[model samples]
Target: MYRAPRGTSDILPREQAYWRYIEQKVVNACQLYGYERIDAPAFEDTKLFSRSVGEDTDIVEKQMYTFEDRGGNKITLRPEGTAPVCRAYLEHGLHNLPQPVKLYYIASIFRYERPQAGRYRQHYQFGFEAIGDDDPALDAEVIDMAWQFFQSLNLRHLSLQLNSIGCKKCRPGYLAILKDYYASHTRDLCSDCKTRLKRNPLRLLDCKKPQCQQIANSAPRSIDYLCPQCDEHFNRVKRYLELLDLPFAVNHRLVRGLDYYTRTVFEIQPEVEGAQTTLGGGGRYDDLIEELGGKPTPALGFAAGIERIILNLKKQNVPIPPLPRPQVFIAHIGDKARDEAIKLAAALRKNGIGVIEAIGNKSLKAQLRQANTLGAHHTVIIGEQEVKTGTVILRDMTTAQQRTIPIVQLQEELR
Candidate 1:
């Protein structure tokens, strides 16, 4: 009578093959890019997010899943991956290892926002981050990685959008322009956008509210106001992208929601997701390391929601992988045969052969039926008659043709 907890989903067995397929591609791609995998806890000190993600953002202000532990310590289920990864980088002293600490993560992140199709409170994210070194090539490399990651997944029609919001140099002035620009239309903007106008005017441009989006249509663009250094850096990033033969577009209004991002922000949006949705986005957050109590460093990275990617895949009618069929099924009769089947199962497992059997299957006919239902490629029958002879019968479930073979030769014979 009970249902799943709100805002959660079960990755059921019938659909797990596709999940594994996507995950395997990610793991392989990460290795190809020289990114070592690191896992941070699902939950962390609540203050980590409050400080790192900014207290004023919706993630901390309205969407975090914070709770008090029995010890009265406040902890929160991580709403995003970067903060936890940064915490681990600092705590474990990864900075001393090398110039750029390259890392990738595939994990579930929690947020307490409204759930909708392709959007969930609990969902998976595939993230990559590169810390250290401020070279423009690094920015291009991060953007390239995002592009290649999606391309490898066969996701098409995604446009890479890039921008630089300037460092401390001219950032405040741009914010002021944005504030001044929005102040005039404050009465026409959404209430949330109006409130954001007073707090972080830059956020008003990011608002998804209908009227806010309409109001921001003519807002001052950030790239036009970038200081000389920021302009040069952004140009260099674009130059590198061209060198790599990658295509991209400049979107000056591309301000990522997080406060840590300082320069060179970008997103990979599916052309089909339209106004209300995007695949994923991230940008340079050079000051994050300094705030995390590490030496000042320029960093840039991006993350994509795995669920949204899968959703798009489904929408495109891309094939979901078929469930794996057992390569061999062991059917046994009597105690001796059962014992032999158990030994055979272990040996097959050691050799990386997938086998399935009900250890307690009481009848030969029943076992065969179960084996056929499981779509096993072959059925290996061990009965008292065959056990005494030190041989087993291998039956092709599909063809109904079988041959008996010595138990010791079973592995090779099947192969």
Candidate 2:
């Protein structure tokens, strides 16, 4: 039998409750924050990512699913969320509307990577972007939204890791210092870190290997090298976060894994011991729009993995509200009853009532058994006598107490 491809899994009915719960929370949070929703296509010109995410980044070099289309254009499945949003902002002329346009998206992100617990090659991400502005207050609001989103889900013990990676003006000098520090410990670095040191030195600080992390712990801090403008910006971000009563820590090694980021970068991580993985993160990509061939536009965003969030929710045993199901199941006793069942089902649905009509021929016992399995609150039984009488046997599945009611009263009874 054919099966789902590796690194991907089917999200069956049993798993939809978690997805629906997370999606509702996302929608509610975005509505409260006044962020409009925008959805970009699943694929885009390959250069869009190669330029905005940095050609040397792992997403471009090894993870992106790139291919030549029938028309001979290089197309790549979206590997990350922010770049596409930025592309949309530029393509659709969102800058003309206002100085700051806030938007959010819940989209499928594709990547090629080793699958592990809570990690998949294709996953859903919830991200929001505030573009066309660079105010520190906006940064606080974005970070606040990220923190409050997780808190809204009843997640506990999360840490806000904050850092300023300086801007284009001061990052060059910081990279020089970082490369100098890493050059001396070349032998101790992993093969990946060794390549990172030569190509993208900032990524070295993001390495997770124990030995590389130890070396990074003592290496140069980017905040120390921030230019005067960036320094002031960082100070104001912290001040605004403090005013908002947000708990954040300044981590020296908190550089994010994107090339477009500058000035402020942060992450939200669960504080669980031995599993302190990041749930989602985004930062100021002040130059991304300019890199994408538009005028310079300052933007900041935050994204969280849906699968990871659900995993943590399960791990913490957080309660999830179950998805709404049909309130009434229609089980018929005979062929004429089944025909009546169809007409009644249509009438009930047209009246805004949820109904699950039984199909095929089955004994009343078997039909009721199916109704019980579906968790339906009430079952409406129709047989030859009921059809002839224009009535239905409404059975309360929970109490096992039923009553004979006219067919016209079924809708009111449900309400």
Tens digit per residue, CA lDDT, model 1, 321-405: 6866669999999998999999999999899899997567568899999998889989999999998999999999899999999
lDDT of each: 0.85, 0.92
Q: List TM-scores for all candidates, in order.
A: 0.92, 0.96
What is the C-alpha lDDT profile of model 2 across 160-204, one tens digit per residue?
A: 999999999999999999999999999999999998888889889
State each model's C-alpha RMSD to the native: 2.3, 1.6
**Model 2: number of backbone collisions:** 0
Top TM-score: which candidate number?
2
